[model samples]
Target chain A: AQSVTQPDIHITVSEGASLELRCNYSYGATPYLFWYVQSPGQGLQLLLKYFSGDTLVQGIKGFEAEFKRSQSSFNLRKPSVHWSDAAEYFCAVGVFGNKLVFGAGTILRVKS
Target chain B: EAGVTQFPSHSVIEKGQTVTLRCDPISGHDNLYWYRRVMGKEIKFLLHFVKESKQDESGMPNNRFLAERTGGTYSTLKVQPAELEDSGVYFCASSQTGLGSSYEQYFGPGTRLTVT
Candidate 1:
């Protein structure tokens, strides 16, 4: 079945440190990949998406993700972590015009 | 434009009772979707609506769940005879269209429904 896997359930990173969250997906065909963030009691916010062309995608709040077709992975990255960046992140995969299949989500805890 | 909006930030009802959820998509968005997430589970797709039509209801759980979008504007999801397993968060999302590869979904704050 088509599904997304977020290997890490919780990650801890100090402020000003770099962070990376791993994500892998399984699908029969080329899929649309996306990264979203959900703060406590807030709605899911789109971080970035990779449809086609240019494997490297940048998003708001200094977030970026790279799509690797060979690995079937779309990992989220950030060069510098901030206290406000701590939140739950979800990786999703979907076909065009369809519902997204999301992963279990990764929680980032920022420590100062 | 305002983002996707859902009614009743929280709802609590007894098992076997019926509950209805409402969603108002973006002003010009023609595609809407419903999703749910149980505790400690992934967010799963429930159904998809293109305009006033039901494009895909493959993920819907059962017949007790009925979704309707009249006039292609706001949408409603009625869950009749709710079960204890239905205690979770229901999210509503919308997109401009469901064609091509541009399926960016703008989500709402979600309604936390608890069936005791």
Candidate 2:
């Protein structure tokens, strides 16, 4: 079965500090990976996606993710954390134009 | 372009009552999908529609749930005799047809359903 794993249930970072949220996936084939963020009382927003080609993919709001095929991981990173960036982040995987299978999300908290 | 929209940002109902949720996809999007996130669980796919046609519905949990898309426009999901376990945030998403980059799905603000 295809599955997405987000290891960190909750993470805390000082505002302006570097941040990284880990994700791992299990799929039988090359997976279409995605990162989505949901702010409080808001819809999920696409952060970035990796279909193929470049291992490192850039997304909106100064976020980026690198797909490590060997590790079956697509970890999200940001150079600096902003208070507004605090939200629930999810990692998802899809195959062959199918619906996405999401991971248990990780909650990020930015402290001033 | 307007984003996908779902009706009734929140709904509270008795366990045995019937409830219907509606979704209007982004204009011109050919693919529509339904998903739900139960408490302490990952968001899971409920079903997918390709222009009013049920493309995939393997994710639907049980027989009491029914989904329909008429004339390939808007869609509705109805739950009869709802149960407490059904309480969750229901999300609808839409995307254009094609491969690779075109497959990116745009999501709507979900409807929170609470079964009392």
Candidate 3:
């Protein structure tokens, strides 16, 4: 079955440090990859998406993700972490038409 | 433009009671989806509605859950005889375009359901 996996359940980083969140997906064909972030009391916001073309996609809030087909991965990255960046991030793959298969999100903690 | 909006940010109800969650998509969006995330679990797709039609409901758990989008406007999800295991954050999302690069879905603040 097609599925998405976010290996790290939680990650902590000091403010201004680089951040990377890993995501792996298993799919028969090239899937539509996406990154979504959810704050404590907010909705899931679209960070970035990879449908076709441009392996690296830019999203809102200074977030970007690279889709590596060979590795079957779409990892989210940010140059510097902000205290406001502490949130739960989800990686999802669109399959079977328009539905999205999501990974068990990873929670990020930004330390001072 | 207004984003997707869900009613009742949180709901706490008895196990056997029925609760209904409502979602109003962006004014022109025709595609709406329902998802649920159990505590410490991945968010799972519950169903999808294209306009007023049931596009896909393969992920719906059982018959106890009924979802409807009347007149392709706002949608509603009603859980009858809610179970203890039904406690989770229920999210509703809407996308403007269909099966294209514009498939980016806009999500609403999820309705947190707690069945006691």
* Model 2 residue B57 distance off true place after TM-score fit, in angstroms: 0.6
| Local accuracy of candidate 1 as per-residue lDDT tens digits, B1-116 | 79999999999999999999999999888889999999999999999988899999988899999999999999999999999999899999998753543378889999999999
Sorted on DockQ, best first, the list reads 3, 2, 1
Q: Which model is ahead, 1 or 3, in terms of lDDT?
A: 3
Give the best candidate by DockQ.
Answer: 3
Docking band of candidate 3: medium
- The ten-residue window of minimal lDDT in model 2 chain B covers B96-105
Worst ten-residue run, lDDT, model 1 chain A?
A: A92-101
Interface RMSD of 3: 1.3
For lDDT, candidate 1 versus 2, the one ahead is: 2
- CAPRI-style class, candidate 1: medium
Query: What fraction of the correct interface contacts does each predicted structure contain?
Result: 0.72, 0.70, 0.75
The runs of at least 3 residues in candidate 1 whose Cα sits more than 4 Å from the true structure, single-residue gaps closed, are: B98-102
Evaluate residue B56 in candidate 2 and report its C-alpha lDDT on the 0 to 100 scale. 90
Output the lDDT of residue B55, model 1: 92
